[model samples]
Target: MKLSISRYNPELDSRPYMQDYEIALVPGDHMLLDVMLRLKQQDSTLSFRKSCREGVCGSDAMSINGRNGLACITPVRTLHGTVVLRPLPSFPIIRDLVVDMTNFFQQYHSIKPWLENPEPPPEKERLQSPAERERLNGAYECILCGCCSSQCPSYWWNPDKFVGPAGLLQAYRFIVDSRDKATDERLENLRGPYRLFRCRTIMNCAEVCPKGLEPSHAIEKTRMRMLHVEASGELDTHTPPAGRPSITN
Candidate 1:
């Protein structure tokens, strides 16, 4: 199989370039990371980032054949036509296939993902019924893959203003949890322009998600929940300042 890869070295290079690699790939032996390793063996100058060969670590995501994908998870046998590898779009490229994740994590942390209880804890861990746990199911499965956030148009503009997919899912995880009692405060924090308006609902995040997770849906639920909170006449939040439109059905 043949794969075209992007190569760059910031300390020694002015611009990036493409290098084609023709590797021997058996039906089951072809993995994206394997192909990259082969290319590096032939030319040490070739560079890419990879961490767990499995998909969980989310370290090897790149544009595979023009689609955002995890190199570790992409099987060589699944590819059609010439494979084109590029850096994830709309990010500052660090080198070859790696991009700066500082902004991504920054947005993630702004949402205050960890459990925050104004109320004191019980004598032991809080317990809930199975039905209650299911409410936050969609958000709890996220592995912070960055595919959703990177593909998000909101993150492309002011990543700081918008809590991207990872953050939104984390927010959803707690928002729906029956044991958590701070939904209103969290909604209040997210009601402001930077929190709600940033998501453009382009669905790019949902499209590229490796786990088939719908981070957009989580964002939509947050929007609706916030609206309901406002409509109850509690926060006295004003009408959504212009330019913010509800994109969910």
Candidate 2:
């Protein structure tokens, strides 16, 4: 099998390059992650990020044959020929196939994933109705693989402010959770330019999600909610965020 891999070295090259590796494979013997591990074993210097080879860690996230996926979950036989593995299209490449996730985390923090409350939960497992828990199917399914954000144009242009797909989905996650009580505050934070307005409904985030999460739909729902709140003349009095970009059709 022929594998094309992306290469980068800050000390030597200004940009990245593609390097090829050839390997022999047997049936049921070569998953993409397994192939990558083989390469690493052969040449320890070869770089890539991976954890939980079973696919839950979301660490081995990369683009294979122009499609974003969990490397561990993708099989070698699935590719027609000459498999091309690249670091995600966007995000600052840390090295070879590893891209820095600092920005993704920052955006995620903007949404505040932790459950906050004015009153403490009763000393028992907080229960949720199955219907309520599934209210935001799109948001609940996000695995934080960064594929959605990496493929997003908004993130490509403005990594600093645009919350990107994963973050927005996380926000939507809490905004609709039955136990969450800060929906209005969450909506207020999204009132800024970098918030809901930045999404173009490009659907790129949904297209590349490995878990089939539809972040685009979540963003759209949030946009409509924000607009309705504003139209109701019930919007809170606060200055619009500075340096926030506008979202246009």
Tell me, by lDDT, which candidate is best: 2
Candidate 2: tens digits of C-alpha lDDT, residues 1-249: 888898997888799999989987756555789878877887787889988887677898998998788989887778778888899887789899889999889989988886767777789966789999779676776778899899988788887888998999998888888888887889888777765667767788899888888898888777767766777867855554554334443
Collision pairs in model 1: none
Candidate lDDT (C-alpha), each:
0.79, 0.82
Worst 10 residues of 2 by lDDT: 240-249
Writing each residue's lDDT as its tens digit, candidate 1 over 1-249 gives 777888777997798888787877655566878877877888787767788888888888888887788988888779877789988877678988888888787767777777777687889988889999879777877777677877777777877688877788788888888887788888887876767667777888889988788888888888888888788987777768567776557
Residue 195 miss distance in model 1 (angstroms): 2.3
Give candidate 2's error at residue 162 in angstroms.
0.9
Model 2, C-alpha of 3: deviation from truth (Å): 0.9
- RMSD for each of the candidates: 1.9, 3.2
**Local error of candidate 1 at residue 31 (angstroms):** 2.4
